[model samples]
Target: MMTDTTQSRGRVEIDDVVIRFKGKQGTVTALERTSHVLEPGTFTSLIGPSGCGKSTLMNAIAGFVTPAEGALRLDGKPITGPSPEVGVIFQQYALFPWFTALNNVRFGLKQFGLSKREEIDRARAALDEVGLAAHADKYPQQLSGGMKQRVAIARTFAVEPKVLLMDEPFGALDAQTRLVMHDLLLGIWRKHKATVLFVTHDVDEALLLSDHVQVMSQAPGRLIRHYHLTQERPRALSRSGNELLEIRDEILGLLHPKTMLADTL
Candidate 1:
């Protein structure tokens, strides 16, 4: 249940953002003049082929990479560096092997200036939210891949960030675990109403979870298309309806025009 205050907090504005990297040869462009707005509390997914700079663009938003050309703003403030208002979940679980699940989550809360008792309480609550309270004492090696990712997610969300940047957070999970995670994530997002920018290479995953799906071009990536999904939530991956299939085909065509053309012929 999102209140008015939380609903109005996480609007993200990307203004003419360009990213580049320096190499031995010269400077290589990663993202080219990309601009878009992620409305408050909405779920947006970035999808493109490999080497399209999907992760690069997301890193800029996370304040891990600085844009060469433009600025990224959140709630009307410029993003100069990582802030507690923005939380990131990476493809790797990224949990500290030495720490137990409870401590891993508590470690993130320590930076927020909470008392030790408060940190413990929040960490416990976060683990409970991710259904890992029973395994709070378990180390990273003791947990499954999905459980480890859940710990990472719990740590991020424990900070109560206004925006969430997830870079293929479920990529390492098994198919069944991924499906379960999708549902769990949606539930948490609905409860907290944080604006989300998810990066994924899987078209179905993008379509299933996103309120808006953004497709980028290969290499020096540029946003080529934006598709708004009006379908109801708790969506299945079955693509059972004509509308879902049509959107899927259109996105597949964009990713592989030659294959789509051959199939049509």
Candidate 2:
């Protein structure tokens, strides 16, 4: 379990943030005056339609895209650029093909100035957490898609980041593999207690993994609803009761009103 002091470290305050992109047509607004706070050590998921700017909002928080109109603060400090304090995982497993799984995990640790032995030990432990310690010597090409993503996750967590930004990290995997990854991620989150902001289009996925699920509108995305789930952890798809089903229906209705209406009729 994390100490109280450490548990208090990852609060993210998004203050009326607006993001824009310049194109041949004109300046297009991606996010429109969005504001929300992710409590320390909590798991929050962002869900929306495609092109709804879910990734854009997450990228702004990661410091990869600067907000045009508002500020993003982490524990009261402004986020100006990418820092090791914030770790990002994308749908693509961004692993180096040449490096072994262990080396890839150790790469981020190198910047921390840990001794060689300590780095190796930490990297091995991270891989073990993700059930990949046995495959530590394998190169990315030798691994399956799931294994590659596991390596990417191990690499990110090896550095002990305060906030984890995952944008559909398991979207590319098969259904079974994605379930396994979900379990691995929940275990890691329970042990580390880092604030997590995950982006996904799956309503069940958001409900299964998140303490809070934020739904966004279509283009020029804005946060439309926030659902706080108070259910027990280790939730299974089979155990989605009436309450969860109702919430799921509401979210689906929000995302696809016409389809939901047609089904209702």
Candidate 3:
């Protein structure tokens, strides 16, 4: 386990998390004794090469997958199984094809046993926050890739989860749209300030969206390095190119350890 001598209001502590999936060919280890503490309300991005098990780690936190060894904690309590306090926004839209944008968010709220009017108001407000209020009546089929993601975001926000987990939310969008979505995400995060863990394979995207960009290794995913963004919050995605590019190079170097220089300079 990584020694974290610090504490935060919304602490997420993982200790000796090991995960393996049995397969016909052989047993595939997704992670090996992974451990890290996420500070309260911090934006953390998990970035690594493909098949590095970023999504697997996320599922563990969301309680979708159980670790073969070790444990996970939220606010000092061990987490087991799915918790309503955590919201998982999948890589795909994950929206009901027949439901309108408003209903999609409303459905999430309703699942929590909220009143009908309360659900509608909260859902409407979330959609408005994502600038999708005008399209509230539209179904997933009518929305664009970015719009569909906006619906998913609105749905997740309406329920007000303690931790928002996103896996490659913008991977399907075009380059320009992806940048725009990144800025939109920053705006929402600034307003809510919830603990967010985003998983992606894009180095620059990780740097652009995270306060801490954690890069994992190939298989049996493990943290190889963490790039801290001490610059500023509310950073512009379009403007962080140079600094993010340098960080991207650093992550790439770590991905190929044989080519990497000494860890500390």
Off by over 4 Å in 1: 1-8, 261-265
lDDT of each: 0.90, 0.92, 0.85
Candidate 2 residue lDDT tens string, 120-183: 9999999999999999999999999999999998899888888999999988889998888999
Query: Residues 2-23, candidate 1, lDDT per residue (tens digit)?
Result: 3456435898999999999998
Superposed on all Cα atoms, the candidates' RMSDs to the truth, in angstroms, are: 3.1, 2.8, 4.9
By summed lDDT, the worst window of 10 consecutive residues in model 2 runs over 1-10
lDDT of 3: 0.85
Output the TM-score of candidate 1.
0.94
Given candidate 2, what's the lDDT at residue 101? 97
Ranking by lDDT: 2, 1, 3
Candidate 2, residue 30: Cα displacement in angstroms equals 0.4
The whole-model C-alpha lDDT of candidate 2 against the native structure comes to: 0.92
